[model samples]
Target chain A: MDSANERTAEEVAWIHRIGQGDKAALQLLYQRYASRIFRFVIRMIKDEAKAEELVNDVMMEIWKSAASFEGRSSPSTWILGIARFRTLNAVRGKKLDTVELSQAPEAVDEGEDASTGKSQEQLRALMRQSIARLSDEHREVVELTFFHDCSYKEIAEILQCPENTVKTRMYHAKAKLKPWLKNMGLAEAELGGVT
Target chain B: MTEQRMDELLAWYANGTLDEAERQEVEAWLENNPDAQLQLAEYEFMQQSVAELGDDEPVFNTEAGLDNLMTRIETEEAANEAVGQQSTSTMLERLQNWLDETLNWNRTPAFARVAMVSQFGLVLALGVVLLLPSETNEGYEVLSGTTPAVIAAGPTATIGFNVDTRLVELQQLLREQQVVIVGGPSAIGTYQIELPKDDLVEARLAALKAHPAVIYLQRNEP
Candidate 1:
């Protein structure tokens, strides 16, 4: 099987254990993806405290729901599913449709992740601006597929669409985004049609 | 593959959705068409740009969140525990109160509550825990003559209710439903005559005649 699928199996086992109230299982799962989960949620929620709370809620759900987990799908997929559910719930309460990812939930690496800081605020703004241009469906799919590294099959499962349709949507999504990215400083050299 | 096929295939290629044969075809197309390689890279980056809108991973401190959450969780859990605790307390209070009431004497002290519930200790405590009921609507159902506790119906029944209501919502509650009107009063609502000969339903139908109304119900109780 694919490596991600294998990893998912491992996670499923850990979750199964966590459901048994094993904090170690939870800790292991936490160590595996807390940063990424936090990152994903922070993008969705745009609040440090709320994002963190959702991250906790997501993991807690994993622990709470582990025993009943039938391994019908990947564990990461399941966890991210929870994250998505929690994020949507949080944002619904916020009365917002789409969340901007530029707002990092909490302090980023002060040095390495400077885009999360002040100097790159304009870049972040441009990024968010470019992204905000897409429809909510497109944005949601892009978030799940690329940023979350979810497979098209996984996305189809998550979004309740045929796999081919996901590809088509992603195709249209990328096509729509190209001109925007190109306008934001990526010249012909970047496109390489001329260069 | 033809250029048009190549274009269609490119959609599947970017997401790696193409099967083995199609992927091979894409590989050949890329090797011969350097232009397609450039297109793929650009597509990938653009995909990232779109992904960035959702890539905002504000640092989520699970520890910190759980810390705060646990406080409230603990509070609610405590309130629940206290609530759960109060039932036995109430039971004991009631028991003591019943004793006081029967004897027509006085109310028992708070400590009497703890003492009386100790006999059913573990069972009541566990019952209090596992059965800490979710908050039910406090609205008085005048039909029931008391505040009706929301009982969780069958899991299947809940699913059916949700689906039916959703259908009703989508179609103004009358789409797939075939209502057979038996007879109802001029007021109220038209009653759906379900049972061919249900006396209770017929009586309900008769009683509803005082007002302009519509009564719709299924009387089949099997």
Candidate 2:
């Protein structure tokens, strides 16, 4: 089997061990996904402390319910689905405001001067800012596809939406992001020129 | 595939997540359209940027988080064990009650009952001789002199009376409520009282429950 499949198999084994009340297996699973889940949650809720707490909460849920996992989806997809659910709930329950692209603060990378031409790092900084500012739905689509490396189907599973909805969200997310790239002097021709 | 369709899939294509057919279609479209290439590049750049968004953020304290999670799991396991023990105790109590009601020794033939008790007493005496210390030679004592006879009357209810209730007061209450003591004040002090079938059983039970002398009550339907 390929590395991805092998990793998935290993994770499934850990989940089985966890179901049998193996604390070491739980620790291994935690080591694998805790940081990723924390990053996803922090991005969604913009609260590091609460994000840390929610990461443990997700792991705790896995420990409690691992025996019920039916292997319907990849373990990563299941983990992200749980993380997304908890993050969204925390957002709604706490009434936390999601940062919109239009209202996002201007990119302020060090040594970034408009007079000088933009470097790759400068452009990357601007891209990060723009992505951070996308609407929650759009940003989630972008992150799941790009950062999380989830296919449209897996994204749909994580978001609990139809595959077509995932596609549409990605389309709108790119549309929203293109303008920001253009504003950073990355027009259609220059997009290819970025080395 | 149409350009609009290709546009919708560009993000997945950039992330290398499209299936073979979808990937081929997107690549074929990209070869024919240079604009699509730029869009794909933009998507690739976006993917790289989003993936690296965490590079600047401080690392999360995973060890501490794991410790906390383990603590919670331990607490949860302890609570579940306590609940399991409690449930077992309750189930055993229910099973004992079921056995008491279903296998009423009082209904057995007197000869068989006496034989079973004699066998039981012999086993107990042997156990006491084998298990007890020599210095601790206190013999078994009978708690009751005789077993109460079984009541074979019509519908009855079992009740427990308050320990401090006077005999006069209990007799007066029974007379007023029109219930007769059929049996018991068994080991647990519960008495079997026969209620009039003409009166509503629930109303009678509710009235009994409200009386100060009565501490517990239950229907004893056969």
Candidate 3:
């Protein structure tokens, strides 16, 4: 099997053991992916406490429903999908949609760069501000693709959207980020192609 | 593919998500299009900036969280097991309690309850007995008075018959039936009958009424 299939088989074995009520197996599984899931959830939820709560919820869900794991996707993708839904629920619980939050005039994060020679850290901070400006959906696509190194297909599965939709959203997200980067004094030559 | 599709493909190509065939296709499209190259360059910049956005680990106590979660799971499973382990008698008691609660039976006085049960049982038993087949018909008797019936004898017999065979047949028929006089002739000169109180009594009285010795016969009670 390829690496992806191999990883899925390994996680499936762990899940089978988890189905047999193996707490140690659950712990092992948690140790393997907890940090990554926390990162993913915290990015989406934007609240540390809620994201942490969601992490626990997602893991507990995995433990209870491990027997139902059909291995249709990789274990990481499956867990990330659960995290996605749980985070969305938490967001809804707070009476907020990412779209609304992004649209809010007060929620804008325009990292106005100083008009002088700036350090790489300042440039990076400005870039982070640019990301903070993108809509929730576009931001998620960017996060899953660039940070998590997920392919268009994996991102589509995680976000429950079509592959073309993922690409389109990325296209729009880049459109939003391009001006922000340009304002940071990064020329087109140094920045390379649109991500 | 349209220029918009080329841009989308370029986006995927920069992210390394496009297959080699699509990557070559985008590369071929980009060869003659510097503007697309510039757009692709901006896309790459954005991709790099987003990738470098640092993710900070949230401050959460994993041990405590897991402990709470495991405790909850254990409690739920234990409760389920306890329900499963309940004895059949306990379930029966619960059912009985529910019935009593629903019907308000527990509020009834003890003696009245017993009396009600006894009456129900008696009615049920009587109904069954009535339904059963017996020598007598069901609902066969309804007395109008408490008085006994009267049978009067004639002065003497006057019949033309083969005397020997007639007497023999009469004796055999009378022997098959059982009859008993309950009282003697009083001032009215009538005998009272108490036995064979059934439908057959009417037939027996008819035979006696046809006899020349029977002056008069009447069934005053049944």
Give every prediction's interface RMSD. Answer: 4.8, 2.4, 3.7
Clashes of each: 20, 0, 13
lDDT of 2 by residue, B177-200 (tens): 788876666666677788877657
lDDT of 1 by residue, B27-143 (tens): 788774666766676556545553453343344555655556446545766898988888877887787677777744356566775665575697788889887865643211222
B-chain TM-score, every candidate?
Answer: 0.34, 0.39, 0.34
Q: Can you write out model 3's per-residue Cα lDDT over B176-210, one digit (the tens) per residue?
A: 44544444343444554443545676567667667
State the displacement of the C-alpha of residue B185, model 1, in Å, after optimal TM-score superposition: 24
Superposition TM-score, candidate 2 onto the true structure = 0.64
What are the lDDT figures for the candidates, one per model? 0.57, 0.80, 0.68
Which run of 10 residues does model 1 chain A get worst, by summed lDDT?
A: A104-113
Which one wins by DockQ: 2 or 3? 2
User: Measured against the native two-chain assembly using Cα atoms, what DockQ does each of the candidate structures obtain, in the order listed?
Assistant: 0.16, 0.47, 0.22
Model 2 residue B55 lDDT score? 53
Error of 2 at A171 (Å): 0.7
lDDT of 3 at B145: 26
Quote the positional error of residue A156 for candidate 3 in Å: 2.6
Itemize residue pairs with steric clashes in candidate 2. Answer: none
Candidate 1 residues A131-177, lDDT tens each?
55566567666666656667767777776678777767766766775
Candidate 1 interface RMSD (Å): 4.8
RMSD of each: 17.3, 14.7, 19.2
